[model samples]
Target: MEKKKRFGVLLCADDSEYVKKKYGGYFQVFVGLLGEEGETWDLFRVVNGELPNDEDIDAYDGFVVTGSCSDAHGDDVWILDLVRLLRRLDSMRKKVLGICFGHQILSRALGGKTGRASKGWDIGVTCIHPSPSNKLLSSLCIPSHLLIIECHRDEVWEPPPHAEVLARSDRTGVEMFRYGEHMMGIQGHPEYTKDILVNLIDRLLRHKHIQTSQAEAAKASLKEKEPDREAWKRLCRSFLKGKSLS
Candidate 1:
């Protein structure tokens, strides 16, 4: 039998040791980044554990960092370790993708900065445009007015010296970027399902991002709109196949 390609999924959040229910969080982002690549999903690291060391990376084809509740600017040791892991992945030319906090870490690791961004949270869906196309896009440029779910308070302020900005939104110009060749980061939660986002919005009720009523209203509206399965498949295929760019 042919060997199945393996990949790494690391979580930066502190998911209390025991999960009361089987649901989303880092797992959701992992599936989003992967989007049904193969029958058996290969996750290297569990949620809320120590980041893996250098030699550990050889076990996977690429790495996917999940969004964390912790801010990238904070002095968390684990956070720093993940950043180091990112650097190693980039140097090795392995595909690296970050979502939300994942996005901030990628930028900061590449000599950029992340903090209590001047831009506030983009809780609901927002339109994104591909500013600069790449080979992965499959020769079909999406409409400039595509709506994607956005949910990050800490935005990526800049891309590294050699990194290029791939997609942007009116709210935050650094919504998406490509570092080096295959490495990429997205501020928006492209992997988010409407149901999951709704639950997440409710989970973050304590935060002053969006009002409970507003989030609830948005959730109701989302039920009517269909999830962009094509976009999900395209991203997954492009990254796994190593043809990402456009």
Candidate 2:
């Protein structure tokens, strides 16, 4: 029998009540999107100061850093710790995939710059054009433009040294980037569904993070176009599983 592949999720956000009730927390949400038969998935609530031990790092075939409510540029202790962990992971060439805040944090760990976007928050469906110059990305067989669900105000101002920009949008310059073959960072939430974005928009409005007008516009945009979920899933799975994309 073949050995089971193990993956770890470094969850950086607290699950909303809606998500907890509907999806059984973010772990299940990620597992639902990325889990496969004969594979074991583990969760670590990094927001609550939980992380994988150094000795146990080798146990996981890959690691995913989930999106967070906190700013990646914040000077919080946990954020600093996560940065150190990422640096260690980079040195070992461990496969690490980052989303939203995770993406910014990963860039920071790898000597990149990140900050709030000048154009403000980008919520709802966004179309990203893949970089034709990236030969590795071309092998993925994805379309020239991919529609993905995005909910972020922070963006990667600059990618790390030796990192290649995978995709970009009109609002965000670095929508997706890759560092070597072992690490990738995505500014959008490909794992999210329309419903999740709706709930998040509502929450953002309630918290005054965004105005009602912005929320309404974002929600409206969703009705106009559906995300390319299957393609995003294929790309993520191929990258994480180290499979031939072609």
Candidate 3:
């Protein structure tokens, strides 16, 4: 019998009540998108200071870093620890994927710059154009413009040294990037559904993270277009699973 493929998720955010009740937390959400049959998925809540031990790092075939409510540039203790962990992953050349805050933190850990977006928060579906410079991306046959669900205040200003930028959008320059063959980062939420985004928007308004007008505008933008969920899933899965486009 073939050995089962193992994957780990470094969850950087605490689950919201709705997510916890409906999906059993963000881990399930990620697995729902990326998990394959006969594969084992594990979770480490980095938000609560949980991480895989160094000795056990090689046990998984790949790992994913989830989005967070905190800024990637902050000096929090857990953030610093997570940075160190990311650096170690890079040195190992293990397959890794990052989303939103995870994307920013990965850039920072790899010697890139990340900070608050100059244009303010981007909280709706936005179009991203993939770069043709990367051979893998070039062969994916993705459209000239791909729409994705984005909800981030921070953006990657510069990618790490030797990293190939895979995609970009009007609001954020580094929508996606790949470091070597084993690592990738994306600034949008492929795991999220429209309902999740709408709930998050309401929470942002309730907590004053965004104004009511801003929230309304974000909601209005969603009606214009939907995210290219299947394309993103295929691209991300191919990269993480080391599959090639035929």
Top lDDT model: 2
lDDT of 2 by residue, 1-246 (tens): 777899999999999999999999999999998989989999999999999999999888899999999999999999999999999999988889999999999999999999999899999999999887765567767889899999999999999998988889999999999998899999999899999999999999998999999999999889999999988887888788875322
Answer with 1 or 2, whichever has the higher TM-score: 2
> In terms of TM-score, which candidate is stronger, 2 or 3?
2
Model 1 misplaced regions, further than 4 Å: 15-25, 32-40, 44-47, 138-141, 206-227, 244-246
Tens digit per residue, CA lDDT, model 1, 116-168:
66766667777677663465653544455556776677887777778888778
Q: What digit string (tens of lDDT, one per residue) describes model 3 on residues 155-192?
A: 99899999888888888889998888888899999999
lDDT (C-alpha) at residue 238 in model 3: 85
TM-score of 2: 0.97
Model with the higher lDDT, candidate 1 or 2: 2
Global fold similarity of model 3 (TM-score): 0.96
